[model samples]
Target: MTREINPFGLRMPPELRELLKREARLNGRSLNAELVARLRTGSDPPDANDPPPRGMRLRTTAVQPRNGWVPTDAERAMLTVFRKLPPEKQLALLTLFE
Candidate 1:
């Protein structure tokens, strides 16, 4: 069953929205429906649950030098505020611009 998620307001660019709609249609679903499906499935979707039929697992890792970056007061405040938000909210903030 679907429920009212945002009763007040949310915003997105018209062109981007149209592009998303077109892509969703090409894949046989609505944008909202696709998002809801992914959300309900958690971080990894259903298809990723089992070992591959080929019995080979693909893995990747990136190694980076540890150069500690000191946080400014503003950065620290923002991190504190951001950490307080729910995972969904954090993901929303991360994706909202991109």
Candidate 2:
């Protein structure tokens, strides 16, 4: 069975947000995932030498079939958020991601 987590609103300094974003990128995680992990671990992030847990994003090669990959629950939630964006905002986000 799927566990439901309630959505939360967070307000933080822009610098802290950027720091988390950078850490998320380095750790191959979404920002929310990184934050949750940090919170659960009492602020110490996982060691950089450790292997990323399963379902963590990995860089793909030409031999991999990207389209055949399944989306993670976090990705699905983000997609839902994306879908709710205004058309121009959606396009802008698409451009940003691309």
lDDT of each: 0.51, 0.61
Local error of candidate 1 at residue 97 (angstroms): 35
lDDT of 1 by residue, 1-98 (tens): 35656643448899977765754554457887654544564565334324221111222222232454445899668757866775446556656656
Model 2 alpha-carbon miss at residue 8, Å: 0.3
Structure candidate 1, residue pairs in collision: none
Q: List the residue pairs that clash in candidate 2.
A: none
lDDT (Cα) of model 1: 0.51
TM-score of model 1 vs. true structure: 0.33
TM-score of each: 0.33, 0.41
In the order shown, the candidates' Cα RMSDs to the true structure are: 15.9, 13.7
Over the stretch 20-50, how does candidate 2's per-residue lDDT look in tens digits?
7866765568999888776776555444334
